[model samples]
Every structure is written in structure tokens, then in C-alpha cells.
Target: MKSRRPKIVVIGGGTGLPVILSNLRDQDVDITAVVTVADDGGSSGIIRHYVNVVPPGDIRNVMVALAEIPGIYKDLFQYRFETTDDFFAGHAIGNLIIAALSEMKGGIFDAVQELSQLMRVNGHIYPAANEPLELHAQFADGTTLRGEAEITAAHKLIKRVWVETSNHHAQPRAAQPVIDAIMDADQIVLGPGSLFTSILPNLMISSVGKAVRESPAEVVYICNIMTQKGETENFTDADHVRVLNEHLGANFIDTVLVNTGKVPDKYIDYQRWDEMSQPVKHDFQGLRSQGCRVISTDFLQLRDNGAFHNGQEVVHELLNLIGQPRFQKDSRG
Candidate 1:
């Protein structure tokens, strides 16, 4: 009999979670994706506003990431309506499927599970909350922003982010499985995704944060390759770690993965000058001082269209970290 594969839990939302999952699925690890549900833009926003369901963008991405179907099924699900008309324009087919299922099951979580079974996903995916909740941000300048879309457009420095309801309850199903996965996991990975929007949103949930802080699994963070324009305009690798620690509390992560490769000057120029984005400067020494073991490597993958990390190079690096003796050593020392 083959040996049992290690159980892995990835926590985040949007494009990043799916990218990570797509790679991990190939490695035969038992994977569980805990997705953020605070999205309030485009098709997801319309559904949430009208029918009152959890945002489905992140969940849809995870489904596509874990999809075992071949040919048109994948293509069809990912297809988007392109039109100038407001009714159907910009809507994704998968988003509609999730909405339909939610209506049938009368709950988004149950609907997601049902769809996961149908998609023949390698593992599981879940929303961070059951009830649709808005994300609220308090800026440093004393301005408060409501809704995820509005917060992103604030174009100002964010002091902190929280759920709209002070008494908001966690979807019991979401918290229980995630806690169980964390407790039994060999490794727990954070992100190579958006810092504030993707990663921190999940961590801000009270139950999720409590479970992560108490789990024995080695928590690894894959720092982003570039700074997001609106969110992390000038953040460095150390700055990213600092904000995460601040939000999740001290000593949250055990290891940090930083990209050490040279980005092509053309790509850098296109991103910086053209896109108004900047490369994330690696601060290895600064990160090490925070009681986390630092692992640096050339983890960049150039795509056909000149995109970076087109595949799962970052995910492989994360798996390699889990096997290292240094990662096994307790950070509390």
C-alpha cells in the first residue's frame, strides 16, 4: 500500500488560492482550501446585493483550480460574457452555477460542497462565512470605507479592516473543518497573494485566527513578487510580514519564503512605469530577526506572454520547506 500523503491546508481568496491549489493537486497531497468571502465586485457583488448570498468569486476560482474535468467543461465554466449591456455583461458562468446551487441548497456552504462533488475536485473548498457580510476599513486619516470594492478604491493607507457586523457569527461549518484541517495538517501555507485583501481577510475572522494561533503545524508564508498598486503600494517583504503579524498577533508564522531571482528589466519597467506597480524588495535579514526562519530561492516562472509564476513554482517551494529540518524545529525556541 502507498503511504498516506500529508494533509495541507491553504488559506486565502481569489486568483492566488486557485493558483496554489492547481499546483498542489498534482503533488497528491490532501488539500483543503479555506477561501475568503468578502468579495463585493462584479458578478459576485450583484448576486450578494440582490439575492443575499456569500460572495462566490473565490469559491469559483478554487473549483476551477481543483477541476478534474476535461475539455469544454473547463472552458465553458471559465467563459465570461462580453457585452456593453449591464444585465449579463462581465458575468462568469461559474459564478452563476454557484448562485444557482446556493438557491437550491438554501446555504452557500452546502452548495459549494455539492458543486465540489460534481466537479470531482481533488480536495475541498469553503467560504469563510455563511451569511453575506461586508468588509469595513478604517483608514489612518480617520476615514472609514464600507464594502470591498469601495475599500480597494479608497486609494489611501489602510489602518485596519474588519467585518461589518460586530456580532457577526462564523459559519460553523467553515470554522470547524478549517480548525480540524489545521490541527491535523503537516504544513499550513499563507500566501503569495494580496496581503490585505486576500490573506488578512481570512485571518481577521476571530475563529480562524484563534485556530491558526493554536495549531501545531508549521505556518509558511510565500511573500508576493510585486507590490499591489492600491493595497501595498511600497511594501517590502519585511513590511508584508510585519502587517501580517500585526493583524494575526505575534509569532503567527514559522517560516518565510522570499523570491531571490532577477526579474527581467523589461518586465520590471512594464510593471512599474506602465502598471504603476513595484517589485517587492526582499528583506531577508529583517525577516529573520522576527523569529521566523527565512528561505530564499529563485522561484520565478516566466509565462508565454511574459507573465511570472505561470505555474506552481511557489507551491513546490512551499512543499520543499515543509520537508526541511529547520522548519520542523520549533520557532518558540
Candidate 2:
């Protein structure tokens, strides 16, 4: 089965990357999760600052998602330290482990590979860059900002965003494995996460973007169900595609999976979903105008009072996209 399974490269970060990968785990497909390493918030930020490594938050989550380990181990890995513990306050067990391993290996990429084996990860989990990456965004108003945390808090319309080394170096490089995975994949998936900080940061890496643009794989964009407040405010699905195409300088996306289900007018809890405000406005015509074959479906599920993509449904569609028709053998002899 492993020899015959279609190889897929799922690219993106934030909470959304895990959802699709967790669902795709049991399928007859080989998965390689290329996660973003640009996060500068919460436990990840603290650990990165002290340890001098890329923030491990997103990579840690991707690891848990792809891991086929014991239930207790998963729980223990996700457990957060209490605020009373001043030294370890708010740090997740896995985040700390990733930080330690990065220090042990002297880089993030090798550290992730080591953990993947220890965790029994069903597929590869690679950080977008082996070093800390600082995200810089230029607003549509000509103003510029740095850091993923800063950009999220800016609440301004962004024109374009790119990645730079945390030490302020202009060049950002993705690992060779990352580039090789995209170039060798049968399908390359983008998104189901923050459009600017999550998905775009990885693509902003010069080499990774080039590989995706040049790869013959079927590129798919999984459009988010809701619009983020400061990030994608009142943005349409086409707006998402437009930014991606502009960044890569080509209409590389071959297909887009869009959620057509109606989110009840008063469905979202403003208190909880403070980041994302409303359902992403659909512009099917515009999506088609971009030369993308759009597959519309009800890929919505409400959990923890927040709206999320129906992982199973999305994974089913992915399997279908790569599934070749089987021919029955004639047994007349």
C-alpha cells in the first residue's frame, strides 16, 4: 500500500493544517506536512526567545496531528503547564520537547525529523524554514509592519507579505526536503489557515514558492470558511486566490475546495471568535475567472462553539481527487 499510495504535500500552518492531516492519516496516501515557522505568539514565542530557535508551536501541533501514538501520550504532550509554575507557565509539554530537541540538533528541521520518529508520525512534518522567520507585511496604505503577531494586531489591509530571517537577513531559505517534497508530490495543498501569516509565510520563502509554481502536481487551495477580522476582513474567496497568484507571479492553483454551507446569521460567538468575524464572502464567478475548477460543498462543522472545516468531507474529496479508476480483471479463463 505504501508503494502504491499517491504522495501528497500539505502546505500551511496554524490549527487548520492539522485538521486535514489528521483526517487524511487513515487514507491510502502519503502525506508530508510543510508547516510554517513564523509564529511569534504564546508559548512558542517565549521558547524561541530563550532557546534561539524557530517557534515550535505550529510544528508541534502538526506533529501531534500526524502522530499515531497512544492516547495518554497525546494528552500528556498537549498538557499545558499552570500559570503558578512561573518557569514553565503556559508552555505545552510538546512545545518544550521540540525546543529541547532543536537545541540538541542545532536546528529545527533535524529536530522535527527526530521527533517524528519518536512520536510515530504517520507522515513527514517539516518546518517551513530551519530558523526563526520574521514575517513582514506592507499595508495597502503604504505602511509596513514586522512580525506575525504585529501584523495580526495591525487591523489594517495588507498589500503583500514576505519572510525574512529573524536576525533581519533579507534571504529566507526552505529546507531541501521541503523543496524536494513539493517538486515530487502528485498533489500540493495550500491553506485552511490564516491567509497572510499562515499560508503566505511558507510560500514567501523564495525556493518553496518556486518549487510549487514549477511542480506539475495538482495544486489545491482549501478556502477558509470565515474571514479573519484584522487579516481577511470582508474578503471574498477570489481575493484569497488573487493574493496567492500575485505572490507566486502565476496562476498555479488548479483547483479550489470551497464551503457552500450557510453559516447562520448569528452563528458565531463574537467573544470566542474575536479574530475572525464573519463568513468569507463567496465569489464563485471570480474564483472561476481565475481559471480554477471550483468544487463547492458543505465542508462546515461547529465545534467548541467555533466553525471548522468538516475534516472527513475534505479528506474524502482529496482522496477522490487522487483516486484512479480501478479496472476489474477478466476471470473468464
Candidate 3:
């Protein structure tokens, strides 16, 4: 009998998730992306304010990443209007498409699944929640901020983060399909995105967090290459893992992918990419203390004077891990 494809669930938002998904699409595996809906920035924020739907910018990009359609179709979907356009200015065509579909379908979850079939997406794209979620962060200075944009712009060290409904009455929850995806996953991956804003917002969802903690899959974290000025300035790799563990109230991460590459400082254009501070410092001992197996290597790709993971390299490692004896034993048992 033919074996079932390995089911991999990637959880996070921002640019990193799509980059990794686009590469994983080429491999023979079942991919499910659990995207964060806590965005309140740029086009997404604008749409959220007016349309009152889960931000579609991240979901739209994830669609393109896993889409098995023509390049022209993808291009048309991703096309963004110029700021000069008054009515629909600064919004991607895909975002508007998702918004329209959400309204037609009466919810974001159903709309994404419908669009996923239309786009011929290789796998599933599940929003971390059905409704729009507000990200609330408490800074180390004892001040609290609401909205993902406000929290990141505060540039203060974050103490912790949680999500709430727009009215702050109901607790946010994931769709049953999302929880089932986590429960059935052969491997689960988190972040190559913002530590607090991009990654945590999804996990902070009570159901999603509980499912992740209790899931049997080997949890992997693709540690960021550079520390962000607002989110993780002067942060070590271990610090990132610690924050994740503390928020979930469990030391659950099983493996961490760290970049041991040297980034040339002068190559970074501070003027353009001001959000990034520097390379994430490594602490092998701290990672071990958290009960994580560290995979350190040269996973860097330098382009546009910015540091990023070479997605092919990262996916190669992921496939290798899935084939290992330990993973086979854990997954089969």
C-alpha cells in the first residue's frame, strides 16, 4: 500500500511563513498553514477597520505561496494599487478578493477554504481564528498596549502577549479543522517571523495553544536570523524559545533551527531595514536547558542587504528530520 504523505503544520504570520511554504510546496508532503489574524497594520489594518473581517493580507500571500496556478493568475491576485488611487489605493487585489468572498460566505474560514480550492492550493490554509483578533501586549515597563501595530511601534520590551475579541468579551478560538490539523500533524513548525507579534498571537488563542501543547508531533521552531528592533532587540536564540515556552506555560518545543551564519554588519542598510537590529546571538546551553535539540548551521541568505533563511536549505532540513529514526518512531507510535 502507498503510504500517506507526512502532514506538516506551519504556524505563524508575516513574510517568513509564505517564504517557507512556497518552498515546501515543491516537496511531497501535506502542508497546513495556521496563519495569525492579529494584524492591524497597513492594508490589512485598513480593511479590518472598515470591513471587520480577519486580515487577509497574510492569508492571501499564503495562498499565492502554495498556489499551483499560472504565474499570471498569481501576479494578478497579488497586484497592489498605487497610493495615488483614491478609493482602492494601497490594497492588493487578492485582499479585496478575500474580503468580498468573506462577505459572500459569511465568515473568513469558509471563504479561505473556498478560495483555496479555486487557487488549486497544494494544502490547507487555516486562519488561527475565525474572527478578527486584537493583540494585547504588556511591556516590561509595566505599560499595556492594544493592537499589533501599537505594540510593535511602542518599541518597548514586551513582558507578555494575549488576544481578545474586538469587544474584549468573548475569548478567541480556532476552528475545529485547525485543532484537528494540529492533532493529526506529523510535524509542527513555528516562526521565522516576529517573536511576539507574528508568532505568539496565533498560539495565544486558547484552543490553539492547548492543542499545540498536547499534540504528539515534534514541534520545531525556525529561529529568526536577526533580532527586530521593536520585538527582539539584543535577544539570544534561547530568549526566543523561553518566551514561547513561558506564554504557553509549558516547555514544549522539541527542536530549534538556529542560524550559525555570520552576517556582515556593513551589508545591512539600517536606513531602509530599520526594524532589524542584528544577528540573533546563540546560546546552546540555554537551548538545552529548555529541553530542545539545536540544529545550528549556515542557514543564511544575503539579499537586498538583509538576512533571510534559504528556504530550500530549511525545507531540506525539515525533510531530513521527518525521515530520521526518532521521528519515525515517535510519529508511528
lDDT of 1 by residue, 207-272 (tens): 787777778788888887767766788888888888888887776778887887767776654543
Clashes of each: 0, 0, 0
State residue 245's C-alpha deviation in candidate 2, in Å: 0.6
- Evaluated at residue 153, the lDDT of candidate 1 is 75
Which segments of candidate 1 are over 4 A away from where they belong? 84-86, 165-173, 268-276, 304-307, 327-330
Model 3 lDDT vs. the true structure? Answer: 0.93
lDDT of 3 by residue, 1-333 (tens): 999999999999999999899999989999999999999999999999999999999999999999999999999999999989999899999999999999999999999999999999999999999899999999998999999989888999999999999988899989999999999998999979998999999999999999998888889999999999889999999999999999998888888999988999699988888888999999999998888888999999999988899999999889988866433223221
Candidate 2 has a TM-score of 0.95
- Model 1 CA RMSD to the hidden true structure, in angstroms: 2.7
Point to the candidate with the largest TM-score: 3
Off by over 4 Å in 2: 1-3, 324-333
Model 2 pairs whose backbones collide: none
Candidate 2 lDDT trough over 10 residues, lowest sum: 324-333
Question: TM-score for all predictions?
Answer: 0.91, 0.95, 0.97
